[model samples]
Target: MPGRGAGRVLCVSEFVRNVRLWFAPQEIREEGGTPDYRFSLANERTFLAWLRTALALIGGGFAVDQFLPDLRWAWRAGLALALLAAGVLCALRAVNHWVRTERAMRRGEDLPVSRFPALLSLVVAVVAVAMVVVVLTGWEG
Candidate 1:
């Protein structure tokens, strides 16, 4: 029997256990770590959601970046940049939200509801509406 493999397996198992334990603080607060874990997972999900939205925006930008036949390449490129910028901004916000939520959880304080993300969402909504208007009226010129 090749028992050397067992030693490697044990080492791997120990490493994973150590890392998982280290993932969260071990101070053993009254609230435990579940809430923190929840907030962390929520943050991760939010990031994924933002990534999906970014993909949609980039795809739309490419699809409609140059609707008119005579539109300049610079115009299309600028739209692409705007879409990418929106994605980057969204990512930054998701990280910021996670950090604040995690900090609150650590301090055993009431988690604060954030308005910044809601405001950003509204901004995106308005931009979407404006984009529709521009696309619809693009042929007028």
Candidate 2:
């Protein structure tokens, strides 16, 4: 029974260590070198900003789905779903971008470029135009 208890404790300890490693602050991978703390902080800030954008998009989707009036069921559903999906996609991309940037910094490589800003702008523009048309034409169902 004592051996069994010790084994259980060891398993739990290993699990906790794995969790810590998964969520720990970014580590320097380069031998005997670390990236500038300021740059790392900036990267973290950018990641947080992207997360905030994702949250806003999700909230907007909920608002459209629950509050918007004078829209057909299909229109509302489509727009809301698109927004929510985009939000989730943005969040996933943010994590990838953060990791890539951090790694590039550690390796002294050029940071990867992203076209998401342009794509997001285009999507928002298209949605805005559609909303305007629907409102101006009084196309309520």
Candidate 3:
């Protein structure tokens, strides 16, 4: 009987620990007093918004790759890859920003500053300009 329930207990404990680590890591959870739940929810909403943007970018990349069969191979690949890369970066930025913002809020500090928004906008603008050139130049496959 000693080991009969040991595996179940271990699995349950591990699952609980993982959930705790993900939602309330000791470092962030233990720091400072708890902020208002409304603020935490607002931060989470912003995180979801960033993730939605990332998903849109990723979907746009796939649509370009799939729908623009007439586009030249180089142009198609370049645009799609740029979008996909931007999506990847956006997703990572989303997570990083969420964690930083949450930690700062927990510690009663000013939110962390980031230039990723400007950088991402520049990337999208450059891609749009390139697309315009491709359209004007008749770069069809």
Candidate 4:
């Protein structure tokens, strides 16, 4: 708290150091319970992984819909809309999932996984495949 810092708050680094001091033991135990940093980081990584997946889906969908020569207007629109929805859903789920995971980890328990991601991914995949089919079929009618 020295230097030229008048009221610089404790950033993550400071907070982490303080947490380390407060729970100095190799394993944090609280009245017959243990706090797990590994679990917290694992959950964080999972959320990050999901977000990355969402971004990739968005990028892939847009690239195909906008830049691909074979994409018809209808197909492109459908794919783009689906991808956009998926991306928004992913962002919403990421925050909620992270909070749920953090809460569970803090209490040293497991929470039920939501099935919405799998269901949404399935719907998105179907839309993507449909787009590809439409592009390939070349409007037989």
lDDT of 4 by residue, 57-119 (tens): 788677866686565677677777778778887866776677555555657677747887778
**For this target, which candidate reaches the highest lDDT against the unseen true structure?**
3
How high is each candidate's TM-score?
0.55, 0.74, 0.79, 0.66
List residue ranges in candidate 1 displaced over 4 A.
1-39, 66-75
| Least well predicted 10-residue stretch by lDDT in candidate 3 | 14-23
List model 1 lDDT by residue over 78-112, tens digit each. 65567667767666555555555555676767875
The TM-score between candidate 1 and the true structure equals 0.55
- Tens-place lDDT per residue, model 2, 12-40, is 78546444534665543532357999998
Decoy 3 TM-score against native = 0.79
Best of the two (3, 4) by TM-score:
3
Candidate 3 lDDT over 1-141, as tens digits, reads 869699889957854554454566776687788889999999999999999999999998998889877788888898999999999989877876787787788888999888889999898899889877877674533
Least well predicted 10-residue stretch by lDDT in candidate 1: 25-34
80 in model 4: Cα distance from truth in Å? 1.2
Worst 10 residues of 2 by lDDT: 24-33
On TM-score, the leading prediction is 3
Candidate 4's C-alpha runs over 4 A off are 1-34, 139-141
**Candidate 3: global Cα-lDDT?**
0.83
TM-score of the candidate numbered 4?
0.66
